[model samples]
Target: MIKEANTTFPIHPLIKSRWSPRVFADTPVSDEAIYTLFEAARWAASSMNEQPWRFIYAKRESDAYKIILKHLAEFNQQWVKNAPVIILTAYKEKFNSGKENFHALHDLGLAMGNLSLQAQSMGLAVHHMAGLDWKKLQEIFNVQEGFHITTAVAVGYYGGDPSVLPEDLEESERAPRKRLPLNTLACEGKWIEQ
Candidate 1:
């Protein structure tokens, strides 16, 4: 099942092929390729096109990459260090005018989604990691104020044998995916429960 997503997911070739991998092979992700993915994300829809999303990325061996690597918790670093690149997704609330700009993060999500899909289309693996260190991320990159770091993703080719992954992870990888019964989450006319 490790490779099953390539055939599923609502996204076209872009998203259907992406998945989170804890291990990435030792290889270089070219700068131009990353730019192409970001370009696709740059075109995603935004609130009034405020374009709240911002991405800070680092290639595997650069000093900037080291900064990103430091922001990850010990657990994530163990597996992610080998990734060809790590991209941090952020959203700026200063662009909005209200007490609540909930849509800022939503917009960032859309951008990241677009980025991930684009990466997949290029035959790359992108893994979203939420167990990020906020303080380290904010401090290390010197990100401008008001932009909250939402997620960090490890991108590259997957490495390590599935057999070597911890038991639970291995089993989870092998299991068929289960989704909610559509009726439970979606409603027909009147917008009421069935």
Candidate 2:
């Protein structure tokens, strides 16, 4: 289940080991470990130190857990059942100055990146998904207008059989990870085609 990245150049082992998995063991994650992951996110760099990122999480046994799960798209709901922890990431829409925080989503992504790496370091798996009912999330979590639900995360230990996943996901779970080459992704004052 360890799908180490096949990086062309040397990269940190923790980065290489991080991936989104659909299959998760049903074992419960420790509360302390969850706090550690969020703690790492709490320190991520943000625009003007706005730190707009916020998280709402629920352990499998909590009532809020089902409320969070109900917001997921059916495809995610299927495999997400195996995860012991569910979390939703949200970001503030504007700064206290009444100015729009254009970088809110970007900063939230940075926080999630930090959290994901921290989870990987702790031998835990994190699967982030954009497939969910935003409206339902707002209603269930009582999210205010200024706060937007960004992504849902499933977290747990890695120990589920690929066969248990849906056909397409099963294949995807076993397939090699792919990413565009740096030349195609970065450029010196000009964009380049892959």
Candidate 3:
């Protein structure tokens, strides 16, 4: 089920096709493909080359998988249960100078952006979620004080039947993708009213 983006400006087919779908197929992404996704993320541009991004991922049926699932909000768990892989993305909260790394979350977003595009190119689907227990996740993974879990990603093929989803979500899953206009999204120098 492809829900291509409705973009105002021309964009790469990959960008148009990349979207976070709630339904995932019960298929296992190959080890090599998974490695390639992370490789793409590893090469994302970082702040001062800090490369603070870190990931903890587990394949389906792994003991760690169950634990990760528990940290997701009940709503996420409903659809994520079918994902073949669940990944936790984290990053350092501060730099070595004890100053806050304002770009930490931005860097994580770049990494995930690379991962998402790569997944789409490989005919895979990736759904990133923020509805997670970040605090409990830190405890579960033994993440240190300097590191913070920022997001969770569910990756797999898109094959789930929307009929099984609750009516509200089913409607959402089938809705046309929407995005802000380019002029509203970006401007020349000063901010312009939409």
TM-score of each: 0.83, 0.95, 0.95
lDDT of 3 by residue, 102-151 (tens): 99889989999999999999889999999999999999789989999988
TM-score of 2: 0.95
The candidate with the higher TM-score, 1 or 2, is 2
lDDT of each: 0.76, 0.90, 0.89
Segments in model 3 whose C-alpha atoms lie over 4 Å from true places: none
Flag clash pairs in model 2.
none
Compared with the true structure, model 3 gives a TM-score of: 0.95
Task: Tell me, by lDDT, which candidate is best.
Answer: 2
Candidate 3 overall lDDT versus native: 0.89
Candidates ranked, most accurate by lDDT first: 2, 3, 1
In model 1, state the lDDT of residue 173: 49
Best model per TM-score: 2
Whose lDDT is higher: candidate 1's or candidate 2's? Answer: 2
**Per-residue lDDT of 50 in model 1:** 89
Q: Give the lowest summed-lDDT range of ten residues in model 3.
A: 179-188
